[model samples]
Target: MSGPGDVLDLIRERRAFTRGDVLEITGMSRMTVATRIDALLEAGLIIESGTEKVAAGRPSRRLEFNTGHAFVIAANVDTTHTTVALTDLAGRVAAEERIEVAVADGPDVTLNAIADRAKHLLADGRIGREDVAAIALSIPGPVDPDTDRPSQPPIMPGWDAYPIPDHLKAALDVPVLVSNDADAAALGEQRVAHPGSRALCFIKVSSGIGTGIVLGGKAYRGTDGGAGDIGHVKIAGHGDLLCQCGARGCLAAAASGRAVARALVDLGKPTASASDVGVYLADGDPDAARLTQAAGRVIGEVVATMVSLLNPSEVVLGGVLASPPLLAGVRETLYPRSLPRATRHLSISQSTLGEKATAVGLAAMVVEREYSASAVNAALARS
Candidate 1:
């Protein structure tokens, strides 16, 4: 018979299990299985889901993860918009809301909007205050991991030294975790799309250009949680363009979504944003294609440097402009620029999680930290 510890391990590893199934799988006696199941149920780590079938008997009861036992709030805050979602332990979005509120106005205004949206989503989802386990927030800036605060938010003019975690905690009465948006997206991709894979990098090419580095299955935030701020790396001879961070000829200034938009405008085109560039690129506009390809080349040069140094297993392209042309541009530049060994094993692919990556990553952070901890502790106690 499997020990109590073995049964708990099985439940934790496999997500959920039924008594008969557990008995067969764990090769445990019926009484021992029933005892362990009873303990887990009493401890609220597992729930009963009515019944199933056995041999010539009445019917066995089914079991599944109790999603309602806890909930998490995830927010993905971008320059142009904010997305809020209420998710359960199973990662299903119970309710979601999006607002056209820009996060560049400062911490006070943006965080208030986020708080309101979160409250509304929670109310709409019918989740009570006590049920919320934690709140994970993604900001489009570097976050001080130790303090969980925004540090020198360059694009966001008034968010410097803002106590984001404290502010959100005060507003929502729940524990809050703040991470860089690109980093969060990378973590989300790892958890939701590329589970068990290590050494991956997610390059976000939206309004700005940023990279998120994950080494050994953990988000590597460097010395001050600003390791992946590649947008500011200067490009040779492109000293005319001014970046929002006040740097001239930075990668972001030369090749971000905003850069593409500005380039199109300079070329006498009537486009306003990177999304517009995507539209034009899809339509095969020569100017848009030309500028996007150029941006991709510049970005690819920077990424090739990274690849040569880190040699990550996979490099995922994401954000609003990770199209074929852009990726082709990246591949075109990276293959020739990077070391032969680095390029040999590298797999460059588009983000499978898309726009939901940040939100999903935030939710995964909450689920992994909050529910998984409780579940594991409860299971251990039962054992």
Candidate 2:
């Protein structure tokens, strides 16, 4: 055990523990445990919550991770809007807001709006800016792992290689972490909804399609941060279709929300974006349902390959068009095409968190990054 950081992790893992329990589990000297525990208490990372009776003479004071020690700013940026939330260290939302800032408006306008809204939320909640540990952002595109910036996003024009973290950090004056929206949503779902699922996949079918994979309770970003760009996966018999990435026969071109909306528009339903498609689906529009179902089947064809490869415990469909018809279509094609072994333990479902999934995931990312053992240790040393 290094010190308070490890102790904090132990307290957080157990929810409530005593100094004697830490000493017993770590096998550290009584004096050393006292020193570490005192340091954490001083830093406000851990707090005493009443006492627990022991077999011996005296009772032991119970300690727990102090969720109020700091807050996290979680922002999920999509094509049409951004959802900003202030979350506790425990990934619980304390306050949230929605802003109408389109990604197509470019980063400057959108990021500034997000920062302004976040500040408003903090003020409304009576939380100081200094109390914020970090900010986590989820964008509707792939983020470069090395630079922490958007990397050649197709629908997100003018965002390629943009210094997203740097821009947000400058505005917020705190550490900023950027991730793909799908990846964030996957992490959020796994942590909140499917806590037992060690391996899971989240497929986001919006204006574009993306996949987020969680293995061993962590988001699996690929070598270049393009692990789940399934929207661009080439589907047979769609060669005539073109994607926003200037590619032909891409899955998104044929079956994404944009594709469905386009088909709906051709049929004279007057839909333009994924949100519109979602409204129609909710209203039980037959044309919209039919198109969404067909799109789901096409997406399922691609997911079948993923199921075979990853053998995930759960596959969640998220994003704007995640509905009953879509889920049904996916089940129709995915199970029939996937191997029996893969399908035996697989459970496919719609997103439980709905629009809040990305924000929850971003909060998880913030907590994991800001409160990791090393980060906590560094803060303690500095203090």
Candidate 3:
């Protein structure tokens, strides 16, 4: 009884399908299936491969969504650098570029540099603006859901309530969706690494600490888009340090990459940022190891409380601080502290996407938003 549009919805939702599979799943007639397939194929929304092996006589051709028909421009903008990538509908980065732009310089300069980098990368990849279906942008700050603007983000001075979406849209001439960097990374991990899991909690420990949560296979942006702003959670008895967010004894204030750097400085070592700390750790510096481990313990305590409450199946540690020793420290504190039921099924692991996770997650957002059943149906109907 389902129509071709309904069948297409199933395919889009599942990301792949075959004619027989569609028929059986949707309970549609053979003629209806043929008509829908013809329409989808003609509309350039789906592609038929050689065949799928069933049993004996012959294999029926398998149909798949065509990724080449469109692409997404994704950017991950941090306080110290920006990484731009062009990805197809399949979430594969076709081209990427990294630029060191100080976000404190002002939004205009930083955003302009990013837009230019994106333009050059797209041209290098031979993908035109029309071929770019959408733009997914990740910023190292909290976003206001209603305004689609950056909130009073820490460290990146002079970018509060900035109209980021409008600026990027004007530059790229495409639809743009913006989100917090940690949230975007969470979505990326969900799409690429753990597609089967329905819920996930991604904790990013970079220049600052943050958390991203995905529920039911979608990023859960809380009211005002600040659900996972765990960086400001207080750590008892650590009241001397000042956080960039103007709070005292906040998690990020005491245990972020910046905090690690400060700890190293206090130990009489010259250090700049967390990346430098990571290099030191990699070079086997004992002091760096000690400071990072301490930071990890603090982060793990927070994560343990989160796990106990959310009961997520997986807890992914990411960003610059998710190093080996840091992970060990988190495990050292979390497993013993969290509720038994919550910690029992929890599989803690480092992020597989690495630094590019947010950029790729941005691309995934574009694909999910622009290539949905209704969008494809509208395109097919127009054609």
Instruction: Specify the highest-TM-score model's number.
Output: 3
Give per-model CA RMSD. Answer: 4.6, 2.4, 2.1
Question: lDDT of each model, Cα atoms only?
Answer: 0.80, 0.89, 0.82
RMSD of 2: 2.4
Candidate 3 clashing pairs, residues 3+ apart or interchain:
none
Query: How would you encode candidate 3's per-residue C-alpha lDDT over 68-169 as one tens digit per residue?
Result: 778887778887888788888666887888888877788898889889987887776567788888877788888887887887776668888988888998
Please give, for residues 20-111, the per-residue lDDT of candidate 1 as tens digits.
67878867678888887776676565777778667766687777545566777888888888888888764567778888888877788888
Best by lDDT: 2
Count of residue pairs whose backbone atoms collide, per candidate: 0, 0, 0
Per residue, candidate 2 scores C-alpha lDDT tens digits across 214-307 of: 9988899898899888999899999999888898999999999999999999998899798899999999999999999999999999999999
TM-score of each: 0.84, 0.92, 0.93
**Evaluation by TM-score, superior candidate among 1 and 3:** 3
How close to the true structure is residue 350 of candidate 3, measured as C-alpha lDDT?
A: 88
Question: What's model 1's overall lDDT?
Answer: 0.80
TM-score of 3: 0.93
